[model samples]
Target chain A: MSFREKIHWVTLVTMILAFGWYFLVYPWRIVASPAGVMATAGMLVPVTIAIIVAMTVATAFLAIRSPREVHAREDERDRNIHMRGTHFGYYPLVVGIWINIFLIFWGIGQAEQLNLMIATLVVAEIVRIGTQLYLYRRGY
Target chain B: MAKPPFTNDIRTLRFLAGEMTQGDLGDRVGVTRQTIAAIEQGKYSPSLEVAFRIARVFGKPLEAVFQWDDAGD
Candidate 1:
């Protein structure tokens, strides 16, 4: 596989694992103080730091293994695939933001609204990465 | 996967051109080897500029390299 493809797989895996741990295992509601709301959210600072470190290591390894491919320029096909994936990604982000706005109009709680916003952003990123992988495997 | 309406003779041309590797052709054409493979396998239709560039690499006209299949579409 190309270096970019390998990077895609690594990022996708890391994103899923990190987000999965936060959403599935981290206890968000344990600390309910207003000031601690974001701190106690599913995505804690420590988890974010861990993910950053993991990604840095993975990228370093990839660059070391294939320095030539890492520096290679992206060509027409790569640009086309990126454009297509971004087009698909845009729809989810717009829809998510619209839903978040509707929730605000409906007078949802502050914490719930924040949660929805975070979830929407995560889903949008998933859509972007998922679509890129699909286009890479299939054809543009 | 279903084949695209466009078909190319890249594999045969590469073979005739001193058994050019996919990577070599991709390098000349400014694309990834995977993209070259995809085009040869009839799974992808390259853009106009890329198609012209591939033809130029083989010293052939674009029509000689790629043919449109009206029936396939």
Candidate 2:
């Protein structure tokens, strides 16, 4: 596999794992009292930390595994694939944000609103990685 | 499905040029071997500069290496 493809695989797997962890903790937060909810949300900070650590570790490992390919400049195909993935990824993000805005205007709960915002970002990332993986497999 | 708009004889040309590997051509052209493979498989159309570089690697003119397929239109 190309260095870029390896990077994509690492990112996709880590993101899914991190988000799955977040979802598993989500219900626990809902069942908490107001004070307990805040405490439970505090656990989310570790999830973010875990994601950052995972990304750094995976990237470092891949870069070390193929130092030459890592240093090589992006070519036309790489740029094309990046742009296409990012562009398509933006769609779900925009839609999610708009829905959140509509919810705000309609007077949704603050905690729920915040959750939606976080979910939006997560879903956008998932879309971005998924689209990139698909494009890489399909070729551009 | 319609055929790709572009096609090339890169695999054949590489063979003629002392059986050059995809990685060798990519190194000459400053791209990844997968990109070369993609081009060979008609899954990609390279930029003009890279296309020229590939042709230059085999000491051939760009037209001799690559061709446009009107059937794609």
Candidate 3:
């Protein structure tokens, strides 16, 4: 695999594991309460930190392992794949925003709105990265 | 996915040119080795500039490297 493809794999797995833990252990019972918002905020700190640290470490290790590929510039194929991935990701983002807007009109709890937004972002990111990975694997 | 509508003779050209590695051609053509491989396999269609670059790398005309597949049409 190319260096970029390996990095994408690492990112996909990391996001899956980190967010999987976040949703699995989240206090869903309190999702309608104010404390639920605080919990979301509190938990986000660690999740963000973990993603950053993991990406940093993984990128460093990969760069070290393949010093030559580390300096390789993004080519046309990479750019094309990225643009297509972003195009796919945009759909989920727009749908999520529309849903959030409707929920606001329905007076959904603040924590619920927050959680919905978070889920939307996670889904969009997954779709984006997944699309890119698929294109890469497909040799596009 | 469907194959590209055209094909290339990159593999044969590379062999004729002392068995040039895809990485070497990519470097000279300003692309990744995988892009060259994808072009060779007809899994991807390169931009006109890149196509010309590949042709130049092999010291051939563009049509010499790539040809349209009329059967696909």
User: How much DockQ does model 1 earn?
Assistant: 0.66
Off by over 4 Å in 2: A28-41, B1-3
Residues A14-45, model 1: lDDT tens digits:
87887777677644564334543564453567
- Of the true interface contacts, what fraction does each candidate have? 0.64, 0.59, 0.64
Ranked by lDDT, top first: 3, 2, 1
* CA lDDT, candidate 2, residue A133: 79
**Relative to the true structure, how large is the alpha-carbon lDDT of every model?**
0.81, 0.83, 0.94
Candidate 2 has which clashing residue pairs, if any? Answer: none
DockQ values per model: 0.66, 0.61, 0.78
Please identify which of the two predictions, 1 or 3, would achieve the higher DockQ against the true structure. 3
Off-target runs (Cα >4 Å) in candidate 3 are none
Question: For residue B52, what is the lDDT in candidate 1?
Answer: 95
Model 1, position A105, has a per-residue lDDT of: 97
Candidate 3 lDDT over B1-73, as tens digits, reads 6888888899999999999999999999999998888888888899999999999998999999999889986
Worst 10 residues of 2 chain A by lDDT: A31-40
Span of ten consecutive residues with least summed lDDT in model 3 chain A: A131-140
Model 1 spans with C-alpha error above 4 angstroms: A28-36
Residue-level lDDT of model 2, residues A1-140, one tens digit each, is 88888888888888788878776767544532455456447857887798889889988988898898888788888888888889988999999999999998997666677677778888898888888778777777
